[model samples]
Target chain A: MFEKKRLHPISIISHIAKQLIDTLFPLLVLVVMKARTVSLGWNIAVPTVVLLYTTLIGFFTWLRFTYQLNERELCIEQGVFLRKKRSIPFERIQGISISAGFFQRLVGVVQVRIETAGNELGKAEAILTAVTKKEAEQIARQIRKVKEGVVHDETIELINRSEQPNDIVFSLRFRDVFLLSVTSGGVFGVLAAIAAFISQLDDFISYDALYRKVQALGFVRNTLSGVVAIFVLFVVAYAISVGRHLLRYAFFTVRKQEDMIVISRGLFEKQLLTVSRKRVQGIIIKENVVQRLLGYVSVHIIHAGGSLDGGESGSVVFCPFMKKERAASVIAACLPEYHIHHEFQALPQRARVRYMLRPVYVFAIPIGMVAYVLRPWGMGLLLLLPIVSYLGYKSYQMAGWAISANQLALRSGMFRIQTIYMLKYRIQSVATSATWLQKRKQLSTLAVAVMPKMFSKVTDVDEKEAEAVYTWMQ
Target chain B: MAQLSKRISERAVSVWRIYALIRFTIFLLVYIIVCFLLMKFDGPKWVVFLLAVLFLADLFLFVLLWPRWRWQRWRYDVREQEIEIEHGVWIIKRTLIPMSRVQHVDLKQGPLLKKYKLASITIFTAATVHEIPALDEQEAEKLRHVISAFVKVDDRDV
Candidate 1:
């Protein structure tokens, strides 16, 4: 048992910095308004009073916040006037993560985040924003020991505090990060962003000026400038994507400690994420069009709870980038139970025509309306037909499902193929649905729902096969 | 499975009609109040005409037609291991909920349901919820008991 103690004194500065960031807009407005209208004496008085008020609040917040860890629970007392005390037992704690940004690293402190299953409001239950690295590591080790059924009284052998042990089960190197950046479908996103920016740019800049200028130039010059503009755009987009990948995934590492998996990464804002094996619902292997051509894959782990971005599936990247050949080895090292090599049961031959019909029907309405409204110009939009039809065919070819004694595997998608492996016990429900057209055609769609609202569906399978799956899952 | 896909109890259709009747009464009340105010203040006639058109559409669709279609489409079946429900009129939807994943079962009766001696059973899982509406009170109670017992067994096995 440890006595109650306040966080490191450096936390006061961090608290003030956090408050400044939170109230930046109002503070900026105050300064601007004061400079424009207030007299010199009033200006000095107002700024001084605001600074004093914020500093007092930060100091009191630091003085009031205290935390303690015992054999069974971690208790925290916080809030100055409100006086909130929270106690979280070891059994209820789902995960403990640590983060240290630039300032925290400079001050030799780490931010500890505790997550519990009972977080109904979808936020960290407790966050100790400033603690020594040694204290953070000790807390993590103790939690892991408790989860592994080791008695707390036992004198555990301590390792070197300065170095994280050489126990990484999976890791991404510099080359892997580069490969992921190049092939992770950044081209489409960058193109979309560029398109949106160009549309909005019209509101800011008069493009008619440039158009008239271009028209005045010779034909060859205008064509040459157009090519140069496109080339520059491509270069800029690729550089930005690759740079983002490098910063976010620098020094990415995953380690297995008993029943827990700990992942830590990042160059600027370091993120440490812990996931309990018991809570992991499934694993998904994804490969975009470019990644597939380059023989690269990324692995994601799905679990119950809101994700880091408060989205569905709570999926985190287990492996950012790996070669096709290395993917099996990585899976074996991290999750041995998930079978990487298996023959999947594909959809029947009749499903091809049905699959081709789907995209045509989906694209028809827009095409029809555009042609009806815009006449000849909309007929040019019919060019999208070939692309959508090809996508539909590819989606049909990729859609498949297979089952084993303990696991079920489903593969779907057109441009980005996703193959998910889920333990049978994790499935909450399985269903088979068919629209009136499909009912007549004797084809159905099978949907299997897992926790955290991940619904895996394989479309255009034989009705009999869908029924068999429904009964088998039960 | 074949037998379970049939429509719910015959009484549920009457229950739906009564539910629609109450809604229609509320709609009528609001319409009369608005119409009275509009005429008193000499509002535009076109606005009142548009409101009347919308109200007529609502009355024909929700009060007159939808209840019968909904009754015909709604179906549910309770199996040993899972519950299956098929619902919706234009685009029918089917859902299956496994018994092992059921966290709890609830039987609820509002004032109308109580007057009619009917209940609705709601089954809850960690991430989602499903309900089978307008069953006989005794049947709803028995289904709740059975599902809870299955949930208890599942917990014990784990």
Candidate 2:
């Protein structure tokens, strides 16, 4: 048992930094508003008052926050003015993720976030923002021992032996990191983020000057220079993606403790991710066209509730990048229960025609309307029909479901192919739908619902096969 | 596999018809007020005529035709392992909820349902919910108890 203790003193600085960031926009707006009307002294006074007030509050917040761990619960007493206290039981703690921002790294401390099952919108049950790395590890070990019902003597011994060797399952190498960025489609994300940033400044900054600069370079008239500019932009985007990946996942390592898997990674901001083996719902093997061509795949674990990515739906990635064979070996080493035989039952040949027709019908209405409106020249747009239909056909080829006794595997998607393996017990419900035309064709769409609203559907399967799967779900 | 496609109570037709009639009346009132405003603003006569025609078509379809179609389409069955529901007129959807996944069962009755001596059963799972509408009150209670029992046993096993 650990006695009540205050957070590391560096937390005061972190707290102040957080407050400054929070008030940055409002302070900027206020300064802009008062610049001409108010005196220079008054302007400076207003900002100083705001900063001093926030700093005082942050100081009190840091002073008040204290935490303790006992046999049953981890109790946190916090809140500056209101004095709120939360007691979270060891059994209720589903996961604990440790993160260290730039300031925390400089100060040699990490932030520990504890999560329970029913937490909504990514809010942790308790967050210890500043704790030493050794203390954080000790707390995690204690929680794990309690969760697994291990005796205190064994746990105390394990904690006492600081040199205990943990089995290292996998480590992301330099080549793996390079392959991840090149194959990840993260360049598009960087481009989109940069575009969004520029768009936000659209009202303040003028793009006409940049456009005129390019125009003055004679690049507009010479098509070769235009192509060169595009190449330059692509290289810039790729470089940004590589830099971002390196910052986030540098020196990534996966280690196996007695009953849990711990992943530690990051360069600028260190992150420690811990997941219990029993809580994983399934594993997903995913690869995009680029990754497939380059012979690489990524692995992610499907766990219910609480997200690691804050806002977006979270998946626990065991390997950010690996060879297809290595991914299978990692899965076998980490989640042996899920590494079962998967016999896939593919979609029927007749269903391929309907899959091909589906997109054609969807595109026909808009394309036909356009062609009808612009009688002669717009007819050229119909050439896109073949391309769309081919994509749909590819989707049909990719979509499949396999059911053995205990496990159900679904393989689907066209552009980014994903093969998900889940135990039958993890499925909440199964549904099949058919339009009147589909009924006549003896085809139906199968939808299987899993926890946290991850619904997998295989379209254009034989109605009888869908029924068989439905019956097997029992 | 046993096929159990049981329809809801026949009185549900009258209940749906009453609901549709109420909706139609409200829509008609709103339509009349809008038409008055349009005429006052010197809107085109043909636009008013088109609106009137569309309102009439809606009235004919929803008030007169849809209740019967809905009653005919809605069917549900409870098996030992799963609950099967077949619904929708145009799309024709079939949903199968595994008994092990059901978290709780709720028996619900509104003023209209009470008036018709009917109730609906709502089954909740982790991901989503399913409902069987317009069952006889006693039947709804029995179904609720049966489902809750299954959910309890499933919870014990887990």
Best by lDDT: 2
Model 1, CA-based lDDT:
0.75
Q: What would the TM-scores of all predictions be?
A: 0.76, 0.78
Q: In terms of TM-score, how similar is model 1 to the real structure? A: 0.76
Candidate 2 structure quality by residue, lDDT tens digits, B1-158? 45556888888888989999998899889889989988899988888899899988988888888888988989888877778888887777888888888888889999999999999999988777899999999999989888776664453222
Off by over 4 Å in 1: A1-89, A120-122, A137-167, A192-238, A305-313, A349-354, A357-382, B1-8, B18-58, B153-158
- Report the error of model 1 at residue A67, Å: 4.8
Most accurate candidate by DockQ? 2
DockQ of each: 0.44, 0.58
Compute the lDDT of residue A207 as modeled in candidate 1: 71
Error of 1 at A131 (Å): 1.5
Q: Each model's interface RMSD (Å)? A: 3.1, 2.6
The pairs that clash in candidate 2 are none
lDDT of each residue in A1-474, candidate 2, tens digit only: 578989998888888888898777557756765677688987788889988998898788889999998888898999987999888988877667778888888888888877776677367778888999788887877787787843121222332332334578988888778778766873346566555444544554346865786578754454466457556766766676777787777778787776667776777776766666666777888887778778888888776657653533446777878888777778888887675343568788888888888889999999989877655656878887897899788888878888876888888876677888878887878888888888888888888877666777888788899889877876
